[model samples]
Target: MRAFACPHCSSLVHFENSVCLNCGSEISYSRPDRAFVLTSTGRQCANLERAGCNWLVTGDGELCDCCALTRTRPADDDADGLAAFALTEAAKRRLLFQIDDLDLPLAGRREDPVGGLAFDLLSSAHEQVVTGHESGIVTLDLAEGDAGHREQMRVQLAEPYRTLLGHLRHETGHWYWEVLVDRAARNEGFRALFGDERASYADAVERHYSSEPPAGWADAYVSAYATMHPWEDWAETFAHYLHVRDTSQTASAFGISVHGPALESEPEESEKDFDALIETWLPLTAALNAVNRSMGLDDLYPFVLAPAVLDKLRFVHDLVVARPAYVPAG
Candidate 1:
């Protein structure tokens, strides 16, 4: 979520910008370069016609890296569904951008058919769709894109926070569990912090919905939903890490510091340092919540991070940073 500037005019631009307003230069995201570049080659993603994807084609005039990860999308004839799909794709692009920034490995079905990253952006209009991750495929219910429908579900489910971006971040956590955590060496440390994931997932879910979290859940878990299972606790905490990292980066990019100059210092690279992340995150969120209250809006960050939760977040941070950059075998 760092600020992007147009290469041609040096004007501030957005990640989703197609045409630079200042210089009128056409823009496209280059996967290899990981930045918005001037498209002198006139190459656009194959999905531009149907999905409004603005990323540059990587090769052979086909789908871009982000779009290629999508195994299925809503129907073209379904206008509402198509609109929702666009929003979902935008959020997914943001997610992928951060993933790339962290230099995490991304394997598609083509690379590993058995277990690799993929997406299923399904519309729930025709049928009920459960949003979850299985293997490496993440399914999202498109109806969540609609503001009204999203709010309705948020209230019904009694969730303090929910959004398209949050869903992508959360589900991708599950995908990473398979890629990064489901192993003998990693599982030992993971269990010590997040509890043994071997516990029956089905039973956990049943118990969670049938009742409520045990007393003082907030002191132990980030959210009530996190208490459902160890896997869920990991995903929820992982999503919060992304949330904190990205938002803190945005704040740094904009020269935002909460305290006065006497206390103000250079922004820390939150992606690399957990202490710096908490240092910047807590103050920023508090100020942000106050600003939202001034405008009669809810708190931007509704959850609190206890000492125990901070330990879990640190675990996620360490695991992510410790992993070597993903390089495909030749």
Candidate 2:
């Protein structure tokens, strides 16, 4: 994610800001353009029904580009109102930023005849009028919004890092491979690295849960669960790609030296090679970890980058920059 500014007053704005803190301007994100644009009549998102959302839909007036992903909303009786919804919406916006930036195809419910991509942000299952839906749709227990609750869940999951952004990035990674990777052209190289994705997913998960992750797993795997199945391996690697790219770009903008083409002053390494990314990222992560230690926090990046992992990163880089085999919208 790159930095965004308040188009109205040029005040720096975060990916999730509904209103600018500096000039009090309203903000809207254009999905098509993959950017946040300002609106004239800025108002709290809570007033959407009465005052309308400042963010325009992809085209105009029909389905605000941001809300187009929604197939269901929380019940009117649900307490938080639009405040919590806005947070979920904002996370989706950031996810879409990656989608548009990489030209990833959207495979929504409309696209799939049966089990397709869909979303539903609702209250928990404790509600009275229960809907018997659960699978393909991502169920974000709205209660997860509480920082304390999220932190506890993070600890419970034994995850190094967990955040709304991280969840969105990881889940979207799953959706991407399901829709993007072409089976016919799935090179032997891909299978060799990630394993045979065609294997039974349920069996793999059962085995993964039953046994402990092998020792020295970090030597090659991006994450522990990534060793379970090829699909997981792909998703884990994909999420890391977003993590590195966004963090590196942000550092570049902020003039925090890590190691890049200009930073190295080495014409050879700076030639937009994968090594350039690593050169900047390694030093930057080291400095970041040191700062975290100063404040008694865990290392920001806890994983090591082995040669095999670098190969995965190179694959992702090529995938992003490669020309797509265009399939006309039907």
Candidate 3:
């Protein structure tokens, strides 16, 4: 996440900041200008107070661009669900910010109902809410917003890491799979790297839980979960790629320098080249894990990226950089 400054007082602010601590001026993020602006300059999102949104909007309905992506949200009367909704929306706003920063294509369902993106932020307290992506919509189980519940599921599923942001990133990956690969006419290229996505998805899910990932799976896959199926592999890899990109940018923005051996190139140079970025990322993550260990916390990044995983990451990198050229078919 990039750092922002309060336009009022020139005090350094953050992406999530809504008010200038130094000047006491209300601020909102203007996505179009990619800068902080006073709400007086433009209307704040309708969900600003309800969902804690700090985005500015300009006449495309009351909701800002990010808030507009939400198709289903907890009702006003559902107190617990609404609380969860706030947390999930915050994570999603961060995800969309990263996606926008990366120059990925982002079209709302209204823009192209057939293949455009939308979100259903639902609570699972009363019913089982499966989190996944389908037909351009990402369904999120808002109950995951509870840290205790999220950690419990992480342990139960034997996942090394899990978070609302990670969930949003992974599901959004499926949306991109359509926009950048399938709809963009790059299926052949995708199949070459990730395997045949046409394989039976239901059967793959059944087999994944019934059997252990093959030995030496880490050498090729970023996570054990990636071994489930080609589509999952792509999403997992995509999420991992987002993890690297966003963390690296935040570190750089905050001047959190790592004594990583691969810091020779400028950040822009790394942005243009996959191997170049990894060169910095690998050592940076090592340094991060070292700090975490010193503080007695789990490693910040618990997974390793082998050569095969690097190949998949490079594919995602290329796709993201070229996203402007892809247009969803109506």
Candidate 4:
């Protein structure tokens, strides 16, 4: 994420800040300007009363673009569910910000009822909610917002790292499959890189759960879960791409640099170049892991990027950069 400052006091502020701490100014994000503005007159999102969403309403509706994408949410009266919903919405805002930064197209169900993006933040306390994406809608179990619950599931699933933001990034990868990859021009290349997504998804799920991933799975896939299906493989790889880009951007904003004779290459400002991104990422992660170790914490990034995984990442990078220009149908 880019550094944000209070428009009034020029003091550093966070994206989630509604009231600037430095100058006691109210702040709301402006979608068109892509920055937080001091707002006394601008209307706040309708969700502000319930969800504490601070994004400004850009049009006739009271909901902001991010809040409008939420088609279903937990009951307002359910205290626990409402708490979880707030955290989930915060992560959703971060994900949407990154997508906007990448210039990715975002259309909601109202725009394309058949295959536009939408979200269902459900509470598993009442119903058994499985987190996954269907068509263009992504469902997330609000229980995942609880850090303890998330950690328990992470251990059960044998995942190295898992979080609300990671879930959003991974699931959106599925939504983008329809938006970016299913077209005629990209299908052949996508199939070659990620394998045939037409392969039986049901069978793959059964096999993946009934048994263990094949030996050396890491050599070919980003995670064992990714070995379940080509669709998952694409999503896992795409999530990693977003992870790298966002973390790298943060590092650049902080003026963090790795300087040594061993690393002679000069750093660049933009992360669009995959090689440059990977170059900055490896050394940065190494240092990060060391820092975590000193603090008696788990490695910040526990997985390694194999050569095959790198190739898949490159494919995703090229796809995003070369995304076709959107042309609305008449």
Whole-model Cα lDDT of every candidate shown, in order:
0.84, 0.65, 0.87, 0.86
Best by lDDT: 3
lDDT of 4: 0.86
Name the regions of candidate 4 deviating beyond 4 angstroms: 260-269, 326-330
Ranking by lDDT: 3, 4, 1, 2
Cα-based TM-score, every candidate: 0.94, 0.81, 0.96, 0.95
Q: Would you list the rank order by TM-score, best first?
A: 3, 4, 1, 2
Mark the 10 consecutive residues where model 2 has the least summed lDDT: 262-271
Model 3, residue 198: distance off in Å is 0.7
* Model 1 pairs in collision: none
The backbone clash count of each candidate, in order, is 0, 3, 0, 0
Backbone clash tally for model 1?
0
Of candidates 4 and 3, the better by TM-score: 3
**Model 2: how far is 20 from its true place, Å?**
3.4
lDDT of 1 by residue, 1-330 (tens): 777878788898888888898989988888787777887755888777677787998867388888889999987799998899989998988999889877767888888777778999999898889999998889999999999999998998889998999999999999787666773258988888899999999999999999968899999899989999999999999999999878877777778887622112233343467776787688888999999999999999998999999999998888778765443322
Tens-place lDDT per residue, model 2, 1-330, is 566778888878876666789988778755544556765432223335522344555443365644656677666666573445556666766676666655655555555535455666665544542221233355455545557767997787667776766666666676555445543265566787777888998899899888888898888888886888887788788889888876776776556784444433221324246677788888889989999999999999987888888888787666665535433222
